[model samples]
Target chain A: MRQNSHGPIGVFDSGVGGLTVLKSLMAHLPHESTVYLGDTARVPYGTKSGEVVTRYSLKNAEFLLEQGVKLLVVACNTASAVALPALEAALPIPVVGVIAPGARAALARTRGGGVGVIGTPGTIRSGAYQRALEAADAKVRVKSRACPLFVPLAEEGWTTGDVPLLTAREYLAEFAREGVDTLVLGCTHYPLLKGVIAEVVGPKVALVDSAEATAQAVAALLTERGGLASAGHAAPTHAYYVTDVPERFVEVGARFLGRPIPAAEQVDLTF
Target chain B: MRQNSHGPIGVFDSGVGGLTVLKSLMAHLPHESTVYLGDTARVPYGTKSGEVVTRYSLKNAEFLLEQGVKLLVVACNTASAVALPALEAALPIPVVGVIAPGARAALARTRGGGVGVIGTPGTIRSGAYQRALEAADAKVRVKSRACPLFVPLAEEGWTTGDVPLLTAREYLAEFAREGVDTLVLGCTHYPLLKGVIAEVVGPKVALVDSAEATAQAVAALLTERGGLASAGHAAPTHAYYVTDVPERFVEVGARFLGRPIPAAEQVDLTF
Candidate 1:
């Protein structure tokens, strides 16, 4: 009944944005095979209701579980905020979400206890990061804002353009006013706009890349479970599945992953 | 069976964005009732494939037809661009889409032969506006740009901020360089950013709002079909439906509709 060291790690996002998490996973655990599912057919789950996102997250997890994964990563912040608990309770494999790891990292980075969290409206409204950070250290004050424009900016490949920078300044002005010492890149897409975000927040504030934090948590969990991929294993494989093709998912995904994705299998999952 | 003159007109969009079109319809045909469907579960048709958009659009039409509507409006611009033909062919009722009306208005407004069209990536890439303009007048040159950021800016209620003005300038500078005398607001959300867009593009360019144009088209079509609600009919009633509930569709929808949405019925449609 136990998961073996050889099974691939399962990761899923609403769309290619979660490639940020997969990139970090590849960096930290190159020996492990990963299977990623992007629900490109119905993306931007961040804008949907908790029930809808939960239903989708469960279905995505089910598809990966069917593929025999050793662990599961809900790489989307909105799903992590609203659906992580349900996924953890349902899935047999160890489940990791981006929220807790990012919260832990932000809590560790902030010297003055003031921490800022930026994400989608759904994620921010769920109060997942604030709850997680407060649960970690009640003394840490969490100031959260939803920079809804970042998703479209990242998708447009305008991360460094004046528009994104101006948008970041507009979204982050409140956090700067509050003098938060640390900020969590709560959504995967935010990492792509890190330059603008960092500049807007200034060098004094530590920017925590939740995707990187998630990878670290995933690594530690695999090691604890004795499910880490053994060294000398055949070259690790990264497989992608999306609900919609002809979407240039492979093209946009390449930008997010920082490498070419030759192809991704088109998939349809029923919830 | 013939559809009754009293039945509500059906309208569907990828999501709440269609409310803008519905609002225009309310003003243009005050005696006619409306049934609006927002496919919130699978929104942002702006990024999906032509075939997929067509399939979803057909399903949306079928659901509306089942409710006994007199006419159908494809309020989503991406749907109008990619799926309008199929919808027009399949639906028995008179079908109207937002594209042709917007294109016609732009063609009429342009004196310099240079027309600029701005929409979502899917709408722009479909070349629907360009082809529509060229079909009407052979010599009218068309320039199209995908202002992806405008959707988010409008939704975030940042339609007038410095960020939106800067983003508009960034997106519209090319149109200025090309000396476009007429610009079509090819997507429903773009109309909300009219102030910023107008300032960026200057006074010489005429802005055509697709929602308003579509409303006019629907009015003319209903009259041609003799399906217009009889004069002296009671004040119009508008009903709303969405695939995802608690999505703040009602709240965000108010901005798009320019009036509060009292409620929306959550629905699940089978394609």
Candidate 2:
């Protein structure tokens, strides 16, 4: 791969959720540098309207493009749901989102076309996953629930315990009743509550982490285009930017990244 | 009271949480009109730094002031905790916040000096309530815990149930261990979880709803200052402004206010 292939992969999320996707990218493709932008000043885009989300997503993408990235990743499920098409059309770089990969993964795993997808309100309301899955397989039956509390639960590091388990049960009970054999963790934060989700979802259902699927998609895309970073590339840089407090980003984000985020910095992305 | 004294009371919250306070204000002082601003564009001030929160609060206050409000209410717990002093120092209008009213209510209820406060990270970290309690009575002991997930639970409308009770227990276990006689629901959102919180805190701890106290304070202050709207004010106006997404605000905020929010509009606050 050329030096151009070694350029950083740019990822933007409403907040720390993208760090999970970034971690997966780093683990799977160690040679590729990455730049992440967390719009913490306006975090939880999941609750906002589609128009506001699209606007923020555009600004976030522009900020990352300004940094000279090889690829753009909409690591936020809400942004991916509402703003993916616009982002892809606006940027010259390949734009990857979690929804399609996740939908595909859920389709592959479901015995019954009955797939239950859970995500933030904006993502579920946007119906991106439902549309993506149905487009791939017209016969597929998709049901989605908006689990808005899961983000706060995940960020609070209450991954396990009765709180998360009960929350999971409250959200997943309808899915169980609907006989969904596959459940897509549509929101980036949902993966943190995986154990609780699995237990509540029971043994019959397969829980798909969108982060893992998205990572595989990124790797496949880069490899197919001969855009994979060379192994000879020196220790790849991983930089992080947040629109608000860097301290809280580093603190809450450490749990999401599964590593201390020492490279996180505060940046104003007014674009 | 003069015509100027009858102007609407200005209230500003980061988002819908303040609608809880606004609800109480309306019920307590049915004649008094209100002008509310929910800074939805930059919601979740709890995660942002003191400087950023202070700046937003100032902008929100100025925006409310421009509407010709008689008094200013910092309806957001995060803003009240971190920006109240700055707002009071800068604004000529009487600035009321949840912190002092909540602290007073807690002190009035505590048989012993031990008091437990549960709120967002910003409110807890600001230590405004702790300082307020101690300042009022030097011997009053205050212990605060950041129940960051509570806001999401409240907004998700999952207040009563096994999940909230379990979550409350997890958060307030330390307070129970400390044997706090009084528990203050410091955050505006916390009032929604009063049932679960009371269950977790038990019979010994009195749960003080800050919204109620703040409303009471507002009523008293207005009465003393001769700023109460007249009985014949003829259907006093209740105006609402949001920095972004008026549709979502009215949708999510109805439950918070326990009333349909029909007067909301969007406005840009550049400051």
User: What DockQ does each listed candidate score?
Assistant: 0.65, 0.56
Q: After superposition, how far is residue A58 of candidate 1 from its true place, in Å?
A: 1.3
Query: In candidate 1, what are the lDDT values of residues B83-194, reduced to their tens digit?
Result: 9889878978888889999989887788965999999988999999999998999888889999888887887788887888988988999988778999999988888899
True contacts kept of each: 0.84, 0.72
Tens digits of per-residue lDDT, candidate 2, B72-178, equal: 98888889999988998998889999889989988999998499888888888888988999999999888989888888788778888788888888899999888
Tens digit per residue, CA lDDT, model 2, A1-271: 3325867999999999988999898888888999999998778899888878888898888889889998998999999999998898898889999899988988889997499999998999999999999999999988889998888888778888888888888888998887889999988898888899989878899998778788999999998888988887688888999988688889889988999988678877642
Sliding window of 10 residues with minimal summed lDDT for model 1 chain B: B262-271
Q: Sort candidate 2 into its docking category.
A: medium
| TM-score of each candidate structure, all chains considered together | 0.95, 0.92
Model 1, global lDDT: 0.88
Interface DockQ of candidate 1: 0.65
Among these predicted structures, which one has the highest TM-score?
Answer: 1
